[model samples]
Target: MSLVDLIARADERGLAASGLACLDRCVPLLGGDDEVLRPLWSSLADGGADGDAWGERLAKARAELDCADPSADTVPGFGPDPAPGSGSGAETETEAETEAAVSDEDRAAALARRMLATAPGDPGASALRAWADACSAAALQIHRLLDVAADGDGPLVAAERRRQVAVLELLAGRGAGGLRPALEVSTEGRRVLRAVVSRRARGRS
Candidate 1:
């Protein structure tokens, strides 16, 4: 089923997980460790997104990511290490590299913060629906921003859509156990994003 269809059928908890999982997968782009969002995942165990546990876990994630500042939308340093003998002029290159890193980090942090903001604990249908829609848009936007391909309408977006669908389907078919498979798919996407960053960095060099 399509992502839209899967989301429509998903309960409140499923919807939250779907969105959270997407953000969690992209943590790599923000220089976050793989297990950073694991606490949030644990809260979803009982098909619930409410109570102190969710809030505490969310706060921990924000702290761990050093994203405690809601206004912290800056992207940290990203891209490949500078190559030797590139002769791009070290001083100028350093300034350019700094700009690139900040830009990427700012954008990435903003996207992740937005995703976190959308998380609602056991929301009603209306709230859940709105959150789901936001998640879809955010997920697509996140992919677009991180994508190395210049074309706005490119294969990257298509692939992200497919992955979203696959994640939702896995949730539908396997319930709680689906989180593992869905996360695996997300890990693959993270690798792709990392590669894109490396490629862009190489091009700059």
Candidate 2:
């Protein structure tokens, strides 16, 4: 199935794999200004966007899909273009052409870390900053958790660690909002880690 198809397969099924597939498709589709991915891409919740509230975020992403700027409040969803009811291969091709406009990314990850490309480090980068803070704390907590739980080799601990790493990756490359429940590598794993991080961060400050 196409990457989009994989994403829409079923929210509870293959969420991580679907996200990876979507990313794979994005490699060739990003960087340009087509604005086609605006609806689908924005809907993803990198990591910080908790699962409970993700649907609202997805809606905003889809609504603002036409906006090209990431900070502009648009994050696209992976929903079928022309909306499941377009009724024609030709329309799909047209949508493809429309999405094809954005072909190259000029961001830090895609480029050579030239600038703070994902989002500015300034306070205005609210989404990026919130997620960043969440992820950073999550990472440290998860690491400590792993070290303490190393001898246990418990599947639960392993699963939690995996989730933390995935969240970190999502924040690092795609910002905190790209990690949709649909894109989650470990489902609720990162969330548990996020709580641990919150307590630790509170203790520190």
Candidate 3:
């Protein structure tokens, strides 16, 4: 089944896992350690029924990611746009413009951070559905931005799409049992993203 079809029919647990897996794979962009979101995943494995546990772990993950403020729309230092300012001269204006422009990397990271920030505390059916859909889009966009190939749909994007579809398929077929393999898929993607982030940093240096 298509990802959209799968998501539309996913149960509450499947939806939560789908969204959390997307964010987990993009953790490198948020500067999160490998285990920062482990609690949240464990909560899911515990059946994801305790909304309180999910909320607590979600808050902790956000804190670990330095996104403690839920109201903040953009990640600090990675804003989608430049801060407004007046330049006194043409040269100053040009410099300001350069500083104000957001890089693809920054925008990608911002989207990842937003995914974390917007995760629902309640994990209801409606909320999880919206967050899952949004995360899928954001994760795909992040991969597209970081993909170095001239083609918009490069290997990174293609792999991400496959992983996403694999995740939903796993959940659809195996129910809660699928969380483990789904996480394995996400872990592979996380490693890929970490490598991409490292390579980009090295290139910049």
Candidate 4:
């Protein structure tokens, strides 16, 4: 099926993983290694997996992927190794090549790509994005809420604020639909949005 068809179908029937899978097929077909793969992987790695679910999938991808060197995995088009004396300080990171570790951004990107490869249009695609986005937003929100509460906003005000947010979220969600269906397909990036919707729905502080 065409990409537009896949996207429209995903939006209708909620098949993010499947949609992503379709995109993966298109990537190579369209020769979008750097443009498509990089962003896709960025989103996936940043998102996450379902414990063993993620690991098993990665294993399969590893088997299929062909890297020039097995020791270190490199982003397809990123700049090469640092200059000989690139180390400013007398020390450097791990004795092993820096390539061993995958940065959060890189991992997210890789995961996104993998999702594209495995389950393109599945709602989990949004879920992955939500999860990644939530970490930071939740952290900040928690800190702010705590500080605000400590200042003695009292449960009444806090409660009302939550209610307001909830109403707003519900209205917004209603404009679309319920939060449950939205969260169901979560992966990493979209999990945070789900929580906010949840908080608004449930009137949580």
Candidate 5:
């Protein structure tokens, strides 16, 4: 089945797993450890995205990601409020321009956080559909932001889309046994992302 069809037919657990797997694979872009999202995956076991386990593990994941370098210029879900008595003229303008130059890592981190935060509490058909849609968009955007191509579509994005579909289809066909295979697919994507990061760093140097 196509990715859309698989998503449309998938049960709540399948939908949640599909989205989470995508984000988990891209965690390297956020400078997150591979194991950081492990607890959230555990929550998906035993038919349980509905319980507090998912929420609790999500909170922990967010916390772990957040604790990295507060002064770093990463994007949060909401932009920080302008500080009281903060300068409003040339200084503000300069700061605004500086902030506009968000790093690729920061942008990827924002997308990952969006996937985590927007996951459906109920994991019902409607909620899961919405969440899955958001994840698809976010995943695509993350790949786009990381793409180094000077002109049009790059190999990175093409591979990411293929990996996304493969993951969903794996779940649809193999059910729970597919998780490992799905993760293996994600691992391949993660390697591609890592190569992209390396290439960008080398260019910068």
Candidate 6:
């Protein structure tokens, strides 16, 4: 089934996992360490019996990532492009392009941070579904922005899509048992994103 269909059919746990997986992979952009989200994952594994656990863990995660205030950040929009001749000469144009690229990366990171910041503390099914859908979009956009190759979808984007699909499929077919393997898929994606982030940082140096 398509990723959309899978998400629509998913239960609360599946939706939570789906959204968390997306955010987890993008954690590199937030300067988060690998284990930062483990508490949330463990809460899901336990079926969220203790509702307070999820909320407390979420608060801790937010504090650690320093994304505690969602309202402080503005959601980005596709504003009009700069007018022609905004910069003159070839060197000026190159600098402009580089600045644009960095701006895109900054926007991408902001999107990822927004995903985390806006995640509901006591997520109901409706909230989880919305978050999952938004995370999917933000994660894909993050990969696309960071992808050095401007080719259609790019390898990074294509792999991210596949991983999202695989995660949902695993949850659909295996239930809670799928969380481990789904997490594994997310881990691989996280590594890829970290490398990309590191490469870009080195390039900027």
> lDDT winner among the candidates?
6
Candidate 5 lDDT score at position 126: 76
Q: How far out, in Å, is residue 147 in model 4? A: 47
Q: In candidate 5, residue 68 scores what lDDT?
A: 30
Alpha-carbon error at 39 in model 1, in Å? 1.5
Highest TM-score model number = 3
lDDT of 5 by residue, 1-205 (tens): 6667777888776788788878876777667877887777777764547888887777678678764332233454236767878867787777777767767667776877667666665566678777877787788778888876654557677777888888888777877777778778877777777777778778889
TM-scores of the candidates are 0.72, 0.22, 0.87, 0.22, 0.76, 0.86
Q: Give the TM-score of candidate 4.
A: 0.22
- lDDT string for model 1 (48-124, tens) is 56657877787777777766654433334433455676556876578576767566446665666766655554456
Give per-residue lDDT, candidate 3, residue 32: 83
Between prediction 3 and prediction 4, which has the larger lDDT? 3
In model 4, the runs with Cα more than 4 Å from the true position are 1-48, 67-71, 80-205
What is residue 18's positional error in candidate 5, in angstroms?
A: 1.3
Q: What is the lDDT of candidate 2?
A: 0.35
- In angstroms, the error of model 3 at 187 is 0.4
Tens digits of lDDT, candidate 2, 107-199: 211221111122222222344334333333333333343333555545545554455444444444444344454344533443443444446
Off by over 4 Å in 2: 1-123, 126-131, 138-158, 170-178, 181-183, 190-205
TM accuracy, model 1: 0.72
As for candidate 1, its clashing pairs are: 74-105, 74-106, 75-105, 75-106, 76-105
Model 3 alpha-carbon drift over 4 Å, by segment:
75-100
Q: How many clashes does the backbone of model 2 have? A: 25
Which sequence of candidate numbers ranks them by lDDT, best first? 6, 3, 5, 1, 2, 4
Indicate the residue-level lDDT of 170 in model 5.
Answer: 76
Taken over the whole model, the C-alpha lDDT of each candidate is 0.70, 0.35, 0.86, 0.34, 0.73, 0.87
How much does candidate 5 score in TM-score?
0.76
lDDT of 3 at 118: 92
